[model samples]
Target: MRLRSLEGRLTLLLALAALTGALVYIGVTEWPLPQAFAWMQEAMGRHASVFQPSRVDIFVICALVLLPLCWWLGHIVMDPVKRLLRALESAVASYRDGDFSISIALNRRDELGDLIHMHNELGQTLREQRQNLAQRELLLDTVVQNTPVALVLTDAGDRVAYANIAARHLFNEGRTLNGLHFATLIADAPEALRKAIEGTEDALFSVEMDGSEETFHLSQRAFRLQGRPHRLQLFRRMTRELSRQEVAAWKRVIRVVSHELNNSLAPISSLAHSGAELARRGDVQRLPGVFATIGERARHLHGFIDGYARFAKLPAPRIAAIEWKPFLDALALHCRFQLQGNAPSQPGWFDPVQIEQVLINLIKNAHESGSAPEGVTLGLNVVGHELRIEVADRGPGMSEAVLAQALLPFYSTKRSGTGLGLALAREISEAHGGRIALANREDGGLRVTLVLPQSATAS
Candidate 1:
């Protein structure tokens, strides 16, 4: 029924041919004689009694008049149809060649107008769909390439399907990661990943990887693809985060340690000079006790100085393969002195020796901040590869002024406090590539936390 199709065109052509043949036959066989008879009848009925025209003359005249009229009528009717057919044919050819811009103009209020309208609608729809697809593709490309963090997409089988430039460089050293396995790219991915893919549980993990001597935190998450069982992994590096914390801890240590050393050494020097003056004055009865007191104070001064020196001269780590369980156990045993009196319960997964020192200093500070029976509580935990060691005190928490200067060397709230202990503890943790921070606990206490690297093993 559609006039735009090839079959319709053939039908129109056949109808036009049949009409032309009929017109030709009528003109040749019946038109001339009828015209001649009409002319003779007009003459006889008006002016002449009898009138006859020769057949040859009559035929010639009739043909001269009739042929031109018939041709004019055919031209008027068929010319427009022929032009319309040519336009339609051209449109069809262009459409077949995948060009949708061609439009046929049909001014008549007829079936041809309807055909043109339908064609225009189809072309516009195609153009819109194409434009929409192009825009979506461009957006997707821009987001993937320009984002700062690495992005990797894998199929259900854990085969790499797509990876952004950042991800490719991180895993494959600038090479493409089109067909590698997810397990192969990461050095010994945890079993959590496999469980995530299998839909057993959600996998969210934060791990520390060995980067030279420094540790880098990598946070990972797994998500399922839309309308599919496939999983996707996302990773982000947290090295800068840890670095910022370490720097803050270092500032605290330097401020506290400097204040403590100045306080003790300055007074010790004056006391020694005073004892020498007493001996010169011949105060024999008081001289022995004064000299002995001077010796005792000097020895105490030496011990404080030695502690500060050790704190300042923390050595770089000589890394080796270490079993975590055994390492923590040994570290705890070394902290027995600190844990002896009114210590908090044992914390989880801490390098006991380092943590013990930190706790001893915090406990000592807490004891000095208040009277007896108001000691501190220490807590440690390993939550998702992050070591959180907290030293909380039941005594009054630090004031704004004290908290502000808490990490500075030799800065203490007490008159007799050396202040080197906390500074030393912070420095030791930092040397192990970790951090220490102090804050007021929510339930009215001072809370100090030391965050350290979990492990540096290859897996």
Candidate 2:
């Protein structure tokens, strides 16, 4: 559009017309006739006996008249057009180069003039709007960069497209976060957030971040940024708060330990005093019964301490491959519950000892759910890159309250239940790159599934 101008086309047409007129005049003079004779002959279809001016004189006369006529007409028309086009071209070039300083002085009171005026006004309006937008964005960026809280903007693809300075420091250790996966930015993406990412629904999420060995509490919300769906995560330092919570937890443990120890020791002390008094007075007949009571109390206390020790001293798993058929056969031979499900063709990777402990806990829980050996079913299947084992039983399912807190340490509903089984199972599952889920079956009973990644089973 900038290369071809209306002024050039009009100028070319006018020059062609002038040249054609001159050529026609020369043809007339060289045809052995003047202009009057040519006109007469054309009208009558015969030569007329009329005296006319010489051809040279006629040529000179036509040249003078036609030259000035063509010049004046072109001056009146193309001069203004050429000026307007020159200004338009220059302004447009500057605009294309991003130099919006365009002031076109097209001094004409015509339609063409109106077009240029409108274009100039539009340019000015656009420039002003851009300036306003820039200032707003500048203020916004300043606020985001200087705030203590971190802000991350993930694009529709769920990659980190934008991160403020605080977010960079908190999530990526002060490194740039562009193009990083959203999951990698935060070590722990909470369960609700995981579901939200799967398109279930938007949810508020709170997760822990152990950044630089200082704990941080991250609060996340789903929101849109610049007309695209994004996630906003805010982080706050929680080192002091976490330290306080840790102290509180230790205090609670001590209190519970003291209570249990006092309960066992109080009766044991009484029994010992009775036995000593019996010894002094030679009451031999009651010695066995009192000593038996003392032995039973001592065993219970030892078991209690052992349970705490087992939970506290869990070792890291040494993952190794195991033959599935042999493993399943051995588990069936040792366990009371009925085994079911298809035998896995591929080997599974996990600590056979640690995983067996987890399986024992699951089987025991299923049996205790009021199910017979035949009523409990142990299932094994491979799902994607993971091995899934499920223990199900036809018994009364757990209540909602019990189901929620059942995974915590020392939380139990049974009279003699130590409550470390499920907690230890959960810890072991996580160590094997797996997880345990407890849910109520649709028909009846509780179903617990252990999902372990197949990568752990790799040779």
Number of the top-ranking candidate, with lDDT as the measure: 2
lDDT of 1 by residue, 28-76 (tens): 4577545666678786686665444466765675567656666766675
Candidate 1, residue 71: Cα displacement in angstroms equals 54
TM-score of every prediction relative to native: 0.38, 0.54
User: For candidate 1, what is the lDDT?
Assistant: 0.63
Q: How well is each residue in 161-277 modelled by candidate 2, as lDDT tens digits?
A: 888999888666899999998875444655644544455333334444454444445566777777878776666666677789688767766766787798789999999999999
The TM-score leader among the candidates is 2
- Candidate 2 has its poorest 10 consecutive residues by lDDT at 200-209
Candidate 2 residues lying further than 4 Å off, grouped into runs, are: 1-149, 153-213, 217-236, 456-459
Clashes of each: 14, 0
Q: Model 2: clashing residue pairs? A: none
Candidate 2 local Cα displacement, residue 73, angstroms? 38
